[model samples]
Target chain A: MTVAIDRATGKRRGDRTPRPGLGRRLKNGYQRHWYAYAMIAPVVIVLGVLVLYPLAYGFYLTLTDADSLNSARTIGVNEIEATYKFVGLDNYADILWGETAYDRFWSHFLWTVVWTAACVTLHYCIGLGLALLLNQKLRGRTFYRLILVLPWAVPTFVTVFGWRFMLADSGIINSALEALHLPAPQWLEDTFWQRFAAIMVNTWCGVPFMMVSLLGGLQSIDSSLYEAAEMDGASAWQRFRHVTLPGLRAVSSTVVLLGVIWTFNQFAIIFLLFGNTAPDAQILVTWAYQLGFGQQPREFAQSAAYGILLLAVLIVFTSFYRRWLNRDEQQLAI
Target chain B: MTTTTVTPAAGPAAPDAAPTATGPRRRRGRGAALASHGVLTVASLIALFPIAWLVFLSLGPDKDDYLHPGRIWSKMTFENYSFVLSETNFWHWLQSSLVVSLGTTVIGVMVAATTGYAVSRMRFPGYRKLMWVLLLTQMFPIAVLIVPMYQILSELRLIDSYLGLVLVYCSTAVPYCAWLLKGYFDTIPFEIDEAGRVDGLSPFGTFFRLILPLARPGLAVAAFYSFITAFGEVAFASTFLLSDTKYTFAVGLQSFVSEHDAQRNLMAATAVLIAIPVSAFFYLVQRNLVTGLTAGGTKG
Candidate 1:
């Protein structure tokens, strides 16, 4: 088959003559690969318009003093008009240093980190624990797995809203607390409790993904490794530490990384829980959206700056993560 | 593929170890297994309790009954459901959600299928780079894009329109779906393409006739994912659509919650109604979903 294709290509080359025009060569190349280009054109066009353009425009917006009300206003120069002024790092400066009404950037930034770390750590521990339990030879494991994974399958908005109601002052949780003769703290009123509740809600929403993914990872481990370790008289804890942890390392890292990004950018649950009112519980994402659209003045540029900072943080984190993963992959290969 | 690495070792060791392993470990294993089961049962209940609570609240008599907590299950009623369905624009929201979600799914699946095929099968310049670009897009926070997207849509006069929302959803859905479909495509043997070529089919013809038929599972997985993403999306939908009648379920549900914060029964009823279709769809395609998602993660 290779020889036949080579011979056909050779004949086509011979038929094209010693020096084909550049246009002819271009046309031939197009003819050869037009179908491939055609297949990919819609995806490229749509993504370019909706994703790439917006991304570039967002960066541009970060450098200007655009707002919701005056977003359409422009200063006329000669024949052209510009809706926004070139503020040149003013938004970033205002958020990072200058005193403004939206000066909660630092606090929100810190909380975003704390929120992500707590959620990811709890999610990993709970998920891995559940997955390991499920991995054991138990009857009706499928039913248990399905029930555990139900949190993931349900729409997140529904679950988050349900949780809000459940944690309400007059709701089931406080009622249960009363039944137990225990005090139920305000879940969403106090700042500390609100942050704690947000983490809990996020953990509840995230654990299923981690559980399912880690379960897959656990299933893929060689049971013979366990037997080998057993033969060596290794304790169960030691075997799990040495064998199971290493086996799950790759999957755990991926799950944690993805979880970090998702939790950091989580908007709906927090938004629904606090509405447009909770300043104490706001993360960078909600803060950015509130700045851009939720508020009266609607500081578009400042919001874009917040977004740019988030993007930078994610990029830095991802690069470091990829480096660590690559090192692990190399070690595994050896 | 990694599963193959385990089988060879496990096959010989299992039978050899079974008899010897059972005697000593059985006693200890029983106790540990019981403990594990107990913990798992509690965990599962904790995981499911909120959803179960929602179901009860939705069924309970009225908002006051829900606030009373202990009075739940005292009397069952369907008045909340009837009220949500009849009194408000719940049906209108449902219809809007269906149209937007279906539109996103159809367009997303079509784009993913073709792009997946091209990237997997064709020898194109920068194809590898393109794949990485798609992956990177998944890491982007949607908040970053919302400002520019709002501006772009407003300029095009697509704000408050289904087409604009669908387009944004398609863009968001495309990157992951394309990568997933591409992973699926990679699993299919190239011999199928060779066979199609020998049978005198063009590249497009082979893709549409042979490759696509074999890749139906991939398409189904992508379609279902796209549908769910669009269906549950709140951020963009809330930002883009202004009118109550044009609101998707997620946005509409939020409005309902804000307007009736004290009315837990009605809120729960609406949440249950909104969740039923997605849960049903998820249950139907769960097997494919797990495999597809894991494959995309591990392989892509």
Candidate 2:
């Protein structure tokens, strides 16, 4: 009746019942939304104090030249005020274009690109192949899955250590290569092999997640689609290309984006595998980390700048990737 | 969408139609099956060999046996294990890891569960923005907050405290679990929520008494995720926890590097110990992991 009257009465509430007062509406809103507000209060408070606060503080740090020697410090009963002056865009400028910064940033940036692309390509290909094989009615499928997923099942720190041991200068891998008279490169020592080792170890750790997710995507595709394709005389390759690829687009898109961002910012593998010594092999995230924590007289502003730049790169990439994904959806619709 | 769990078994049965492809194709299917098995065997071996080698290395009595590489098979012993157990801060590290992990899991899952339930059941103000915010949180790397977090934690005198570590980890784990659990909650039918409201139950009561019990699997997945994340986290734990007793396995293992070559054997033994329980838990929850992740992924 109130809905009917409101519709008939020029969008006002029923004339017989006036709208609540401002205070009353406030009370009503609270009553209606308090449960939701209460439920979210814990997370809101925690994220607010911990995450958002630091995030804001980090942004502030990026605008100044804060460092260990200059930043304000509290020593016992004495206080030292921060003298690091504001330097907007200078840290970014230095890292992005300054002469010495060019070599440091660009070299690390190039390797990071190569590392991400190689690892993601390997992960997707190996994961998809294994997934396709497992999608068949094969014997010992569960056994194969259990074994293949072992690297991911183990903690990354532990598996990386395992890889470190195996790839050591006189480790088993080189020993095996030596016995066979093949080239046994210094995996941990040499630059090329160190980068290769990092990517290989990361791929080993990353593939299981991709495989499992893609397997789920494969499982969810209707058998009727396959039958229809078979009826149309599609070849095995045709069916895979047309039906399987399109069907996996949803899962693959998300996973690949995640793979790129993850590989770009991957800290544990590089850190655990090479520690801080392999400056040449360090990714941008680890390099930023080293600046802030690893070095003496920590350069907080520069570290924060590097972090902010990485975040910007990811945000821009994600938005573009999302737009591209949506366009693909539109093209499919057309 | 929720039934992806049951589809894996039904999915592979499509191969029954593959053999009858006509055009002189063999109905035997032996070649394809054999090739699949062969490839899988090779892959499985590739995956398993590294872990197996670690276990083997952990048994060496001499610290430098790994360097020599040939004497390990002849002289394997549990000396490294006993040594790591008795001659180090293994128990304290284990306690710290478990405490921090469990604390993060408990706090992370509880907060996220309520938020998940709220966002699932209600369209309160900022509901749409909440989802976007949760997604954005994932994009933030640890580098963004480490220095400021150090300052904040130190200001509050929480640098060497488990409370500080758990709080920092909660920042990482909560949003992720919330996204995952929200997706899980969506899979549960809304009619149950309605029925609880009709029975004179308040929203909180309905959520607790009805929805929470049914959401056990989702809650378990969230718990496992949070636990594993806090367990293996390196950056925050390494930075904040300065003292050895406060160190998790990640920081503790890092300290082993400067202790020289004998610690390699000890590190192997310790690595095995660290990996075992976490891996066991992973195997237990791997099935739900796919479901939880994709649920949050596709929907969010």
Winning candidate number (lDDT): 2
Q: Each model's DockQ?
A: 0.40, 0.39
Instruction: Provide the clash count, candidate 1.
Output: 0
Interface RMSD of 1: 8.9
lDDT of 1 by residue, B22-92 (tens): 55456555656677789889999998999988888888866767677666656788999999899988989
Tens digit per residue, CA lDDT, model 2, B1-300: 222123222333123323454433443356567777988999999999999999988998776777776788888889888888998999999999999999999988988989988876665677767766776678787789888988778778899999999999988899989988887887787778768867978889999999999999999998998888788888888789999988999889888877553368888899998888889989988999888887767655
lDDT of 1: 0.79
CAPRI category for model 2: acceptable
Report lDDT per candidate: 0.79, 0.82
Off by over 4 Å in 1: A1-36, A73-83, A100-103, A332-334, B1-21
- The residue ranges of model 2 lying beyond 4 angstroms of the native Cα positions read A1-34, A74-79, B1-28, B260-262
* Location of the lowest summed lDDT over 10 successive residues in candidate 2 chain A: A1-10
Q: In model 2, what is the error at residue A88, expressed in angstroms?
A: 2.5
